[model samples]
Target: MSDIGRTSAVALVGVRGTLVEVEAHLTSQLPTFSIIGLPDTSLGEARERVRSAATVADCPLPSRRITVNLTPASVPKRGSGFDLAIAMAVLAAAGTAPGADRRTVYVGELGLDGRVRPVLGIIPVVLAARDAGVDRVVLPVGNLAEAQAVPGVTLTGVDSLRSAAIDAGADLPAGFVEPVLLPVPSDDTPPPLELADVVGNATGVRAVITAAAGGHHVLLLGPPGAGKTMLAERLPALLPDLDTDAALEVAAVRSVAGHGVRSWTHRPPWEAPHHSASAAALIGGGSAQLRPGAVSRATRGVLFLDEATEFPRVVLDALRQPLEAGRITVHRAGGSAEFPARCQLVLAANPCPCGNAGTVGGPACTCPPSAVRRYLGRLSGPLLDRIDIRVAVARVTTGTLRASDGTAPTTDAARRSIGDARERMRSRLRGTGWTTNADVTGAWLRSDGRAAPGASDLLDRALDLGTLTMRGWDRVMRLAWTIADLDGDDRPDRRHVERALALRMAL
Candidate 1:
């Protein structure tokens, strides 16, 4: 005699998920088990784990040939989250448990002790199930809170294979012991970094405000201890909170990167990769499973690259694509995956290797001119051109440090200004499918969002004189619009254009 059982599962590729069918076939032959449908190394090992777990859970497989297949077979599936579905399918085919509902998606890794352990990317997996119109999901108990973050889905959290089988209408032996659920670790958010803590560097602070206001990238060049890092860190505080869709997207990225997502928050993320990070680490690639990199993690937030010049030139140059496209696609031998990377890039670097070459009145420079040029040359022209704001942060004098007149900008004040500016941008770009000045194209800016009459004369001159590329002209126009919005102007005027030009040429 022969029997067939089927269930559903989700395969995550980057932040997206694809629904996969788990089908098991039982036949009266010598006892053997095999899994097919392009399973990866970790997924292929599910055979042993499922067998051991089913036995310990008192749901031993029938003494018959078993063939488990994940279809459509062309799609490459990775991870051990498929264990539960495979086990349930085998048991159902053996007539031990009732067949699983095809509408319900199963997602969780199984241990040898019959425990169903949580796996990464549950958020995206559940999200995929929701997107695929599968409203019910059976996952590990540990991920209940995370799965609850996504609405419109009925969740059934199981602690063990036996409990899952019982939930699936299996006739198990009596003496059911209630399973103990482990408490999910709380997602504790640290206190917000205050903008008021920065002592000096008014220009640096203003540059950060412009960045937060328009979602523009910034480059901060200065000596050490000039408050560059402080300014960069506080930019997020000056921006508004993320909306529901954005928060969910960010949570999905975190979940896929193995950073547990207990709940979603409106606060944007911040990623600061070290200089020693490889290209794969920054751009997102791996041999086993393609993972999200720092750029993807910083989607809808800030990506701070401190000591920017210390990074490898290739690694620095790799950011151009994500900055331009607002998304990153990692190609591997297995396949390709895309991740959202629309982030505000904040780069802080010393003027030279010795860190005192550009200071007004600090230690004398010891590094040679060639060394300084080489250090700064690591930042390619193409990469630098993509940055919208370039400001030189000079060392703060002792007099300036002590001359606080109680007029320093606070996070609340900056946030209000940025929020108002962003609102204005959204209004202006209502039907354009864009919400920030930086996202507007040159054609749109020239035709619809043009500056006041005769306001762009200097910009025209610069463009004609070969000092600025077309890309630079567009960037300056965007910066000018952001400045005008911050000042409550109907449109950019001469003053705004001049200020934007000065900021762009500050380095």
Candidate 2:
């Protein structure tokens, strides 16, 4: 005779979770134990950990043929999160208690001493559980805060297998649940970086503002000391706070990366990768498990690529799809996982090998013309076309530096302006799934007739003159809308289109 016990669990396919059922079977046969169904090495070792944990917690497993299976066998299971569920299922099958409980989720790694350890991706797993109609979740005490961040769900944090089994209505050793507090720094928070230090490059600063307002990508080209890096650094300060849904998404990415939320600010993330970063480091691919790359971490944020010309062509080209689709899928021999990557791409580069091309120091540029072509050629036209704002930053002169512009707005003021513009966009785009001008499709703009007087004629002239591709034309229109929103215009007109074209064509 054989007895069966069941419970539910979760596995992170990417930044999302796929529900998995844990089934435990016990039979009166030759004493042995095994785990079937597709499981990575991490999940395979869970058996030893769970058995030892159950024994230490005074709920010993029967010395018989014991088997555990993760249903939907074709789906590859990774991580050690299934430990609790497996242990509970086995105990129930042994007639120890009602261990294999339903209407809930069990996700935690088991230790040799029966301690329930925290695992990666608590937020996404909990979000998936809520979506799957599971209301209660049993997580490690350390993951309580992140699990609590998801509303409308009952959370029970346990310190060990003993506590978890008891809470699940199992007849096991009773113990008090020790609440694990999230880590907090002892030092006071430091003051924020100021944006006003970046003098000169007023055009670049304005372009940053426009990009912040619409979530459009930007490309900056200039010699050194032109404030390219400084401008990019200040962009996050200009961006407004993220809403609940966006914060949750960002937190999910952070959790999967094993990076705790050091400072839980709603500010958009900024990731500036070195030019030598590999395709997998920037775009995310691995041997067995796919990971979140710089692009994925920059979701709803800025991904600044400095010294853009030095990066490998293939690595840079990998960004094209995610830019268009707002997500990326990493397909390996084992499986594929899709991660959201709707980040604003910011590319900064020098004009030539000498970093002085096309500037006042142009006469001193030592690189040959062939070398220059080879340098700038790395950025393909197709990739550059997706960028909405392309500006040439120039080094500031002494005279410009001495003059004080006290009336210039600081980061807070610029953020207020961006926030107001975003609000206006949301009002117009309500129920449309687009919150900013950059995300609005050209077809929607044309169909809704938001383009103003003499706009099409100007766009048509640019297209005929071979200055803009079909994609570039649409991007220009979107940038124009962002500009109009900043200037408090309800519709984009010829002036906005002209300025947008100027920014886009300067490259």
Candidate 3:
């Protein structure tokens, strides 16, 4: 008699999950099991896991030669998510009904004791199945909440290998109790922190707010005590909530990186890489599986770099492409994967080598002028020019600290203004596929988004006088458009361009 059956699972290629066909065959010979296809070490180990799980679940295997193949045999399968699927295929080949196995997608790790353990990247797997017109997905009970994030797909939860077999129409053991899925807890999202918490430095506070309003990159230069880090942390709170599609993409990235998502109502993420981070960590790279890095983690959110000068120039230069294109492509010998990295950049640095060189009341700096110049020069001109807002934060005064608490704009107030600005930009850019003022290109701005006649004259004079390069002129125009949107102006004027120029070149 012929003995062969097939099931399905998913393999995460980068952040995108592709459906994989799991087929099992049993031959009459001295019992030996082997798994084929280009599976990594973790997936190759699933054979022993599936065997032990089946034995514990009261399914005795007849001594026969068994071979499993994960088809699309050229694709690299990395994780152990195929364990349950492999077990079900084996059971079907052993004479269980194969109808359910043909209709559903199976993904979960099976333990030796018949327990089904949670695996990473569940969202992308279920999403891929649903998109492929496979309506039913049977995954671990622990993953049901995550599966709920994507609608339009039927989800089945199983806690052990025995349950999966029963779902596949295998006969249940006598007196076996059906597994109950536990209810996931609901955790309240705490209120976002306020911009009013910072003591002083109005320019620093304003620069952050403007950065949020325009989706512009920012550079904060000051001493250690100037509230640079605090300002960067609060920028996300003042920004608008992501739309449905953007939120799903963001959640998918987090899932692929092995972080579980309890809910999709998550805020835009924040990543603050230390000065010692490597280029691969900042951008994305790996020998086994090319993973998303800090930039991809900070997609549609903020990436703060404190002590920016301490980072090696090579590592820092790696950001230029993502900053321009809003995505990064990592090429490995196995393959290449592109990750979305459209993050708002924030870099905080000190004024000089000693940090006290230019301070008013601080002690004299010992470093020579040449040393100070070389220290700050690490931030290349091209990279610094890409940053739209540059603000120097001065030391907070005693009088400023003694003043009332609500001295500056609150994050709530700033959030309201920023939301209005974003809405305005969206309305203006409805058919342009650009959501924010920052995404507007230099060519597009020049062609269709010209400033008022008065503002245009001022900008032309600045360009002719060599105060602005061609790129600088474009960035200034982008900033002016953002300022105009924030103020509800129909078009930018000279005043807005002046403010934009001041905020533009402070490297």
Off by over 4 Å in 2: 172-191, 261-265, 361-363, 402-407
Superposed Cα deviation of residue 8, candidate 2 (Å)? 0.8
**Per-residue lDDT of candidate 1, residues 245-318 (tens digit):** 98999999988876664446688888899999999999899877899999998999989999999999999999
Q: What is the C-alpha lDDT profile of model 3 across 297-362, one tens digit per residue? A: 889988899999888888888999999999999999878788889999999998888887677776
Q: Which wins on TM-score, candidate 1 or candidate 3?
A: 1
Best by TM-score: 1
For every candidate structure, what is the RMSD over all alpha carbons to the true structure, in angstroms? 2.0, 2.4, 3.1
Error of 2 at 400 (Å): 2.4
Weakest 10 consecutive residues of candidate 1 by summed lDDT:
174-183
Clashes of each: 0, 0, 0
Q: Candidate 1 vs candidate 3: which has greater lDDT?
A: 1
On the 0 to 100 scale, the lDDT of residue 21 in model 1 is 95
| lDDT score, candidate 3, position 279 | 95
Off by over 4 Å in 1: 173-190, 402-404
Q: What is the alpha-carbon lDDT for the whole of candidate 3? A: 0.83
In terms of lDDT, model 2 sits at 0.84
lDDT of 2 by residue, 186-282 (tens): 4332235566676765788788889999999999999987889888888877888889889888888877876543423476777888999999999
